[model samples]
Target chain A: MKVLALDTSNRPLSVSVLNYDKVLATTTITTQRKHAAYAMQTIEDLVKVAKLKPSDLDRVVVAQGPGSYTGLRVAVTIGKVLSDTLKIDLVGISSLLALSLNVEKEGQLVAPTFDARNDILFTGLYRITSNGPKSVLPDQHISFEEWLKQLDQFDESIVFVGEDVANFKARLQAHFGTNFKSVVGIDNLPQAARIGIYGEQQRPVSDIDTFVPDYLRLTQAESDWQKLHPGEGHESYVEQV
Target chain B: MKNENSLILSFETSCDETSVAVIKNGKEILSNIVATQIKSHQRFGGVVPEVASRHHIEQITICLNDALQKAGVTYSDLTGVAITYGPGLVGSLLVGITAAKVVAWAHQLPLIPVNHIAGHIYATNFDHPIEFPALALVVSGGHTELVWMPKEGEFKIIGETRDDAAGETYDKIGRVLGINYPAGPQVDQMAHLGHDTFAFPRAMEKNDNFDFSFSGLKSAFINTVHHADQINATLDKNDLATSFQQAVIDVLVSKAMRALDKYPAKEFILAGGVAANRGLRERLDQELEKRDVEFVKAPLKLCGDNAAMIGAAAEMLQRHGAKADMSLNANPGLEFEWAENEEE
Candidate 1:
């Protein structure tokens, strides 16, 4: 089975070609906002290198997001179109969960942290055993100290894996000291290869009709519109209990 | 299956509506469902992107199901997925992108990334097969441009909005006249009610190039309203509307005629949300007829943003053997692929 995976859920954009269960080629570009401009060419180059035509793929995978709203959309749109164009099934892996896949640990928790701005971090408390995380943490934006406090309650050494973790490292060391660790060097960032790895262990939704992006924050425009038109209440949110 | 007509499931959530459509053979729209957020944005006087994105999720499922039922097809019958990738609200674009990607993966289909403006332009394909080396004028809420296309799917922006877009000017004028936020439809309606009794400024009417600027005219209208209120002078709203609409129509028509006269193409395509303007369409038809140039315009009902248009554009990509993998991403500002290494 050929699976093409991409991670554009954060500031950086990553794409990879995976066959069966092995990674053949991976390209991750970390920049402020060049994902949309750079992603297609990179994918084309990867396809050329992999000797794959658009129709040879079996499934398209994307790192769905709880971070960078625009980045998330970039990954999702490309994945949808590629899978659709190639006649393949699509799999969506949580970008945060995908971040955890890069850290190889026997008994450590994979804690992925993304900068959410406004003094908040979009974080997930994860643990990677032989099995994936026993349970992925809630995807939410909370203060870094507040998040660390929540982590202190858990009874395990945590390995944080994400590029944004570097931004809060000093404070993180102050909190957990030797109790905390992170993905070494560039492995600290999200990679499409990792998203592919996570997608491998998960199941795709039975119907694409039920899927949606997990944008943790309401855009400022929506909030303003709500304020301007308070006359009628908003339609019910789509999330199911 | 290779010979089977490609089935494209397309989604458009760029603004104010959540739309889904299944197009078979590109020209035939099998099922198209759109959940309008007009009532939701009625109080805001304008679209709120955040609200639009949220609404898209709530509406995408019903739209998808309706498209499937209307098309008489299942995921098993699909060939590829298509979606409007950008040049719209960033938030609004994501909802469609997310759903389309997942379904594409579930069905193991190719993904086609569509430029929304291109989709609007391609909507003409439903009614007619366009020839090469054509000129397309894309006028909408967020954009206004004269794009030269030497062949299908290749676009070159020869001229564009220098300041406020034509649609934005219409909306702002509508606001001054106490009309709805998007003044295009209202202006079109009002233009029919009265004659152009007053002369409004047509900025750059003498310019040889196709570039447009509506800021000066819009400011003039707003200033007129404010000045009238201060001086206690009563201004006829309908006359003002007619006069303003006439000015816009004149400039647009004049520019289009100039483009037709030079670097002539066999056909002229009008596209984007603002293309629904009755005044503009009628004028284009009358003007283009004089030149004996073939004209293609999207159906009025399909003029605004929608998934069916995206499906139409996606069909061309499929014909070119373009395919997207799971990593296909949403591009808020993805320029229309005009030529190699050039983006509009």
Candidate 2:
């Protein structure tokens, strides 16, 4: 089973072509705001290096949102189009989970944090078990302080994984001290192989058209409009307006 | 599935519309699917870039599938993938560009990057072939420019708006009337029903340069309505719309005629979203007829952002051997220039 996985939900863009559990080829490019520019080209290059045609791929996996909005759209949009066009299944993996896959040790908590700007972070907690990473905390958009407060309950040492880990490293140390640990260097970046493996273990989307990026937050316009039309959560902003 | 007929799949997501098309050879559009977000943006009174990007990603795949299925063509039958790569909101443009790049690279098909304005100009070709040395007046929500195309597929910006675009000005003025978001057509409709009452200033009409300035006119219109409200005077909505539309049309027609007189061309094509304006189209037709220059008004549907136009422009690029590689990025300000320096 050939699976093509893509992860551009963060600063580092990663693409991997895998044959079931075996990795055939993987490519990564670390450049901010260059994911959309390099994403498809990297995927094409990876497929070429793997000596396979686009049609040879059986499934497509993509790291869905909770990271950069444009970056997530790049992967999800292409994944949907490719899967639909190639008549293959498409699976969406949490970007937070993909980041957690950077942690190699078992019996440790993998806490992936993506900077959401203004001191807020899109983060989640996952436990690294022998059977892949298991979700311990659902993806949430909260302030760093609030997120740290929620993590106080876990007794195990936590390994924060993600490109933005460095940004909050100092604050994280102040919060949990010795209990808080982070993977430094390349291991911190999310990889497409991780997305592929995680997706292989998950179910494919039943309807490709309905599947979209999991943007945890609303657009500024929508948020503002919602504020004006208070208590109109059930209705769409357009309809309420 | 490679055959004598080369099918080019195209995408356009420069703004609130997510469009996909399958064009056979350039002239024939097998299928053109446009999923517009106008309804979604109507509440915002204008296009929100973030909202537009979100819609494009969601609608692109569906549009692509529909375009292919409607055309009854498979990926193997495709000759290339063409996409509008710029002169649009970055977030919106990236969705289409990324989608195009992926499909092109995945299938090993050539990718053709098309300028949005070029797409609008080529949209007129769906009805008839554009004559060389054509002077095209491109007007849309984001742009208002006079492009001098000396030969087929060559573009030269003769003049452009210095301030608000003609369509943008109409929208801003239309907001006072509580009209729908895109006010070009609404103002045009009201213009046909009422007389041009108020004398709105037509900026840069007497100037020798072909450049336009609509900011002054827009402010004048806004001030007129606001002043009337202060004085408790109820102004006629239709007359206001008529006068504003006339002001815009006067400036546009004047600049276009100036460009045409300076550089005589075989054809004068009116393209872009504002080309759908009834008053502007009629005026251009009358003037071009007097000059004996063939007038081509873009089809109302083609005047807006769509993939068929991108497909048409891509055909010209393909003929000129202007295939974009995987390195092509979505340029927010992708400009077009004359390609006379390149070999055919």
Candidate 3:
């Protein structure tokens, strides 16, 4: 099966064309907010290098959010349009899971994180299982201090992955000591190939129109509205007004 | 691709409107689809950047398909792709940029980056081509500026607002009157119903320079409303709206007339969101008519925000070989730089 996958949920924008489990062509650009400018050209070039047209793709996979709001929207928009336009199966994967699955260590706990500003991180804990990295903790947006406290309760060594890990490296090392091992390199960046592999294991979205990026946190405006109207349903300010 | 046969597909998401349009030779708009998120933002009293970005992503492809279908064209027929890259919300602009980049790359076409404010000004060309030495009054929610165009594709910003844009001031004052988000049209309607009872202060009115200041006017309007509220005195909403609108129009017209005297252009353009105002449009028409200058305003439907104007701007850019490579990125505060004169 020919699969085209994209990951722009974080700083690094990755695009890959794959045949089944093996990767045919992949490009990873480690630039901030360049997703909109570079993702399509990379995807088109990758597909062309692999000698396939957009219509020949069997499935489309993309990294669903909980990271940069604009970055995630870039990839998700392309993914949805390509999949829906070509009438192909569309699959969405957690961005943090894609970063964690990049770790090759077996039985190692992977805690992939993306900086969420204000000392918070969009992160989740995963354990490398026989099949792949299984989620030990679901994706969430929490402060680094809180997430570190949760990691302290774990008994095994944790492998920190993702481009933003360096931002909290000193604190991570202080907390985990010898048990914490850092995986820092180009390979640690979120890869579309990983997204494609994991997407195969998951079910495709039944309705493409209803699918949206999984922005874990509400926008500032939405939050402000919520604070003003306590315990109100999430019907949006426009509807309520 | 050039000339009358050239087909440009444009994307515009610099604000709450997600628009896509297919234009031929820059002037003929075959299809212009604008999926507005005004309702989604009305409750928040303004556009929420995140919501605008999300909606742009969801509607971009649909708008793209509709534009192509309505134009009776296909990707193969597209000569180039165009998009508004900046001077608005970064998040909102990125969606259109990404979508346009992808479509252009997939089809192996040149990507033309357009300025959003320029697009607003260029909307005047939808039915009629702009004459050379054109003077434009660009007024929108985010901008209030006077641009001088010596020739086609040449723009120079001679004057602009230092504080709040005219449309922004309208919305802010509209909130005081308990109106919905995007108070420009609502306030204009109310202004038409009542007379200007209170003579509001026209900020920077007597200034020698063309630069404007509306923050003082906004403050005065807010303070008056609050003072009235404190005394439990009822205020006429129409009169307040009329008084505020008159103040804004007074300053805008004064600055524009000053520019006209300095530049002496043959053509005058009323562009952007506030260009739809009944008072401003009539005032410019009457004012420009005295000078024997052709007065052109963006059609009411195209005045808000749409991609058709972007398509028109792209056609102009393509003539100058202003193609954006893969390194093109969205600039939230993008400025229009005329490269043609520099090369000359």
Candidate 4:
């Protein structure tokens, strides 16, 4: 099965066409939130390098986010359209989990960090179990100090993943010293290929009829209402098809 | 191929709505599907960028299929793809751009880049074929600008809002009155019932150019309401809405007329969601007639945010040989440099 992968969930834009077990072509570009304009160009260049036509693709996959709002939206939006036009399945995968999936070390704990601004990180603790990378902690907004406290329990070497790690590298190194291993990920900050593999495993059907972005934050309006009204329960929307 | 027409699929996810449309020959709209996040944002009183983007992805496919099916055309039949490239919420723009890009690549069709403002002006082409070398006033929640298009597809902005747009002021005024968001339409409706007894100051009315400032009027409305509430004075919502809307209309109409006087253009195009204002349309039509200038306003549906306008602009762009080879980009800070001059 052929899979097309794309990610605009951060500063970097990434795309990959994977042939099930093998990668045909993968591309990553790091730019300032220019994903909407550059995303298609990157995809075209990749398609040309792979000697493939857009029609040849079997499925479309994209990184669903806990990352940049603009990046995630563009990636997922394109993913849905491509799958719909090609009459293929569509898949949405978590960007954080995808980052964890790219860790090279086989053992020990891995924590992927995403800068959530206001000095907070969209982060979670993970352990590479025999099955695969398994979550040790749920994704949540935590202060840098709080996260370091969570990581203090493990005496083993821990590998940090994600671009957010760079911003806090000094504090992290100062706290963990040599116990923490610092490494630069693949040139591209985003890993669209993981989205494809995850999509295949999840096998989400393209319901061009019904699909939406998975933004973890409440809309500004919702927040405004909540603040203005004070103590109103969050209204749940029964998404209509 | 000796084809007389080109089928263009257009997408607009620039704001609260995720819209898709199929335009044939620029003017004929086979289908226009809009999945509005209105309800989603109703409780919040405004659009949320994150939520808007999320909604765009979910509705992208449904909207695409609905348009194609309504147009009675398959993906293979499309000759080109068009998408709104700017002057909107960047995140929202990304969603539509991404979709348009993939369609362009998948179909191996030429990509057409469309300016949202250009599309709003082109919406006038929906009802009446516009005469060239005309002036267009684009007013919406996000924008308020006077543009001069000397020829087809070339846009130059002349005057614009220094603060809140005409629609933004409407929404702000509406909020103080407990009306739904986008109080522009509701206020317009209410204005018909009440007289302009309260004369809110019109900013920049005496300016030589068509520059506008709705923020002062907005603050004036808010302070008036707050003062009334503080002094325990009764206020009529409808009269207040009407009076406020009238203030905006007077200034808008006057400025539009001023533009007509300075530049003798073939047509006057009213664009953007605010163009749906009945008061503005009627006033402009009457005023433009006095000047003997042709007036073109987009159909009520096209006036608001939709992909059909994008398709319209794209059709003109394609006709002008402006083919985007996957190089089209989102320009959130998009501005018409030529618009700095009333006519160039």
Candidate 5:
């Protein structure tokens, strides 16, 4: 199976073409440039390097959100269009799970984090098993301090992964002391090759038309509105209007 | 797939609408599917950027599918892909751009990045073929500008709003009257019911430059309502609406007349969401007829943001060799590039 996988959920963008367990070509760029500007071109280049055309790909895999709203849309929109147009299988891998895949260790607790600004982080807990990174706690938008408080319950040594891990390393070390393991450098970045491999084992989205990134949090406007009308459940305001 | 026909798949998610269209040679719209978020934004009193973006992502693919199915064309039949890339909410614009770019890349088609204002002006093409040197008075919720097009695909802003857009002012004033968001249509309806009692000031009405300023007029309208409220005097809403509408129409018509005398365009185009105002359209039509200039009012249904207009504009841009690669990004503050030697 030929797979084209991409991750534009954060500042670092990764694109890869894979054939089953083999990574044909992969590129990861950590830059300040918007993912929208270079994501399609990066995918095209990686496909060319893999000696494959976009049509040759049987499945499109993407690291679906819990990251930057614009960044998530950039990848998800591309994924949706490509998959729909080419009539191929479309799979969405959790961005946090993709980040956790960088840790190859078996039976190690991993916490993948993306800095969501204003002291909030899009973080999740996962266990790196031989099969893949299994979700111990699903991805969520949370405060860094609050996330650490929740993590304090686990007695096992936690290996923190992701580029944003550097931002909170001091507090993490201060809290967990020697029990905290921060994986720095290239391993912290999301790998599309790993995402493609894992996604290959997953089921494709039943309906590509309704596929959307997992934003993992409500927009500030919605949150403010919900606060004012407490009993109104989290049903979309778009539908009500 | 790859037919001889010039079929273009277009997208317009610049603001509150998620629209997709199939244009044949940029003149005929086979299918133009517009999923509006007006009702969704009514609760917030205006479009929330994040909410708009969310709605756009959800509706883009659905619109694209409907557009293709309605047009009876597949990806292979499309020669190019076009999208509104600027002068809108960045988050909202990116959804369309991302989708367009992927379509272009996947099909190995030319990608045309269209300006939102340009799309509005070209919407007149659906009514009649635009004759050059055309003068377009573009008015909408986000913009108010006098665009001068010397020839096809060339855009230069001759005049513009110094403050709030004409439609934005209408919404702001409407909020004071307990009307819904997008107050232009409601205000227009009310204006026809009553006389212009207040005769609100027309800011920069006689200015040498074609620039407009509605902030002062907006403040004055607000003061009038507030003063009445303080005195417990309930002013007639129809009269208030009439007065405000007259003030806006007078300034717009006067400025258009002045521009027509100077530029001598064969066609004068009224476009954008505010262009749908009945009073403004009638006033411009009367004034343009007196000047013997051809008046091209964009089809009312096509006045608001839509992909059909973007598709129409893309045909003109493509003729001028306007194309973009995968690196194109949504420019929130994008404006028309000044025509050479036309910059003030």
Candidate 6:
């Protein structure tokens, strides 16, 4: 199956085209720019370099949420529209899981993180296996101090990956000591080629019309509303209004 | 793939509405579908940018599919894709821009970038062919402007609001009256049932320039209501509505008349969300009938943000060789370029 995969869930943007497991062409830009400005252009260029038309693709895989809210929408919106218009399958891969693909050691614990401001981080825990990275703990948005407390329970050597790990490197070293491992430079960035490979094993969304990025946290407005009206059903504030 | 009949697929998510439309030659709407988030924003008493963005991403593709299916057209039949790329919530605008760019790339169709305010002015194309040297009074929740167009594709801002927009003023005062969000239509309805007893101040009514200021009027209205509450006296809500509406209309109409006299346009257009006001529409129609200028009020249904109007504006823009590539990004503060040799 021919596939296109994209990730814009952070400052870095990646686009890749593959034929099954072989990546035909891929481009990853680490510099910060408006992802919305160059995401589709990069996809178009990569597809041409891969010598394929948009209609020739069989599926689209996108890195969906737990990062910048606007950045996640750029990729998800593009993925949803391309799949819908071309009548192809659409698969959403967890962004944190995709980052964990950088770890090659078997049975090693991998923690992928993104800074969520106010000392909060969007992070998750995954374990590497021969097949791929498997989620051990789900992705979540929590403060750095709280996340460190959760990691204290695990005794395995933990490898921290992601561009944002640099922000808390000292604190991580102080806590994990000899058990802490970190990957910097290129390996820390997300690779769309890895996303395409993992997505091939996942099921396509049953309803493309209602697909949305998994933003691990509620919007500030919704959180405030919930606090004001406690003990109420947590149904959609949109539907209730 | 250029179709014999020009068919443009357009997207508009500049504000709270996610609208998609297929236009035939820009004049006839094949199918326009709008999914509004007014109910969701009503709880917040105003639009929350984050909530609006969330709603837009969910509704965009749904509207696109419905629009194409209702129009009975496929990607192969489209000549181009157009989208609103400016003067709106950045998060909301990016959703439409990203979707439109993908459609254009997948179908190898030309991509057209349109300004949201231009889309409002072009809504009048459905009513009549806008004559050359047309003058437009554009008013909405976010904007109030007097735009002058010398020809089909040329635009210049002659005047605009110095403070709060006319619709924004209505909403602020409406909140004081305990009305729901977007109280323009309801406030307009109440104005017809009562006399103008409060005699609200009409700011910038006699100013030489076409610029408007509604902040003073908003402050005056708030002060009157708070004073009434302190004195243990009740002022009639209907009378307050009438007084506020009259003050707004007087300033808008007087400034519009002044602009028409200065520019001497062949046609006059009343455009944007506030254009749907019955009082403003009737007053402009009566006032314009006395002059040689032709009056054009946007169709009530098309006054709010919609893709049909964006497609209409894109047709004119395309004829003038306007196109954008995937590098286009939303400009949240975009405004009409001052007309050539007309900039102050």
Work out the TM-score per prediction.
0.74, 0.95, 0.88, 0.89, 0.97, 0.97
Model 6, A89-183: lDDT tens digits are 99998899989988899999999999988899999999999989888888999999999999998997999999999999999999999889999
Candidate 1 lDDT over residue span B1-344, tens digit each: 44488788998887777888998888988987877877666556777676766667556766877888889988778888898878788777766776676576545578888888888888888877777788889998888888888887677877778998899899889988998877788888888898787687998989867789999999888998899999999988888988999999899889988877875888899998889998899999899888767888878878877788899889997788767765555667776543333332
- DockQ for candidate 2: 0.50
User: In what order do the candidates fall by DockQ, top score first?
Assistant: 5, 6, 4, 2, 3, 1
Q: Give lDDT tens digits, candidate 4, residues B240-285.
A: 9878988898888889888878777988888899999998888887
Worst 10 residues of 2 chain B by lDDT: B335-344
Question: How would you encode candidate 2's per-residue C-alpha lDDT over B18-71 as one tens digit per residue?
Answer: 899999889999999988888778768899999999988878778989999999
Give candidate 1's whole-model lDDT: 0.78
- The clash count for each model shown is 34, 0, 0, 6, 0, 0
For candidate 5, write residues B35-149 as lDDT tens digits.
9888778767899999999999888888999999999998888888999999999999999999998889888899999999999998988656799999999999999999889
Steric clash pairs (candidate 3):
none
The C-alpha lDDT values of all candidates are 0.78, 0.87, 0.85, 0.80, 0.90, 0.91
Give the C-alpha lDDT of model 5. Answer: 0.90
Model 4: colliding residue pairs: A8-A71, A211-B58, A212-B58, A221-B44, B156-B339, B157-B339
Better of 3 and 5 by DockQ: 5
Alpha carbon deviation, residue B214, candidate 5 (Å)? 0.8
Report the number of backbone clashes for model 6. Answer: 0
Which numbered prediction scores highest in lDDT against the true structure?
Answer: 6
Better of 4 and 6 by TM-score: 6
**Candidate 1: tens digits of C-alpha lDDT, residues A85-127:** 3446889877787887776675668788888877789888776
Q: How well is each residue in A112-169 modelled by candidate 3, as lDDT tens digits?
A: 8888888999999999988899999989999999998888889778888887888988
Q: Kindly report the docking quality category of candidate 1.
A: incorrect
Q: What is the interface RMSD of candidate 3, in Å?
A: 4.4
Residue A137, candidate 2: Cα error in Å is 1.8
Which DockQ values do the candidates obtain, in the order shown? Answer: 0.14, 0.50, 0.39, 0.51, 0.59, 0.57
Docking level for model 5 = medium
Model 3: CA > 4 A from native: A1-3, A27-33, A38-60, A84-89, A105-109, A117-119, A143-158, A163-187, A200-206, A230-241, B1-4, B337-344
Residue B16 alpha-carbon offset, candidate 3, angstroms: 0.8
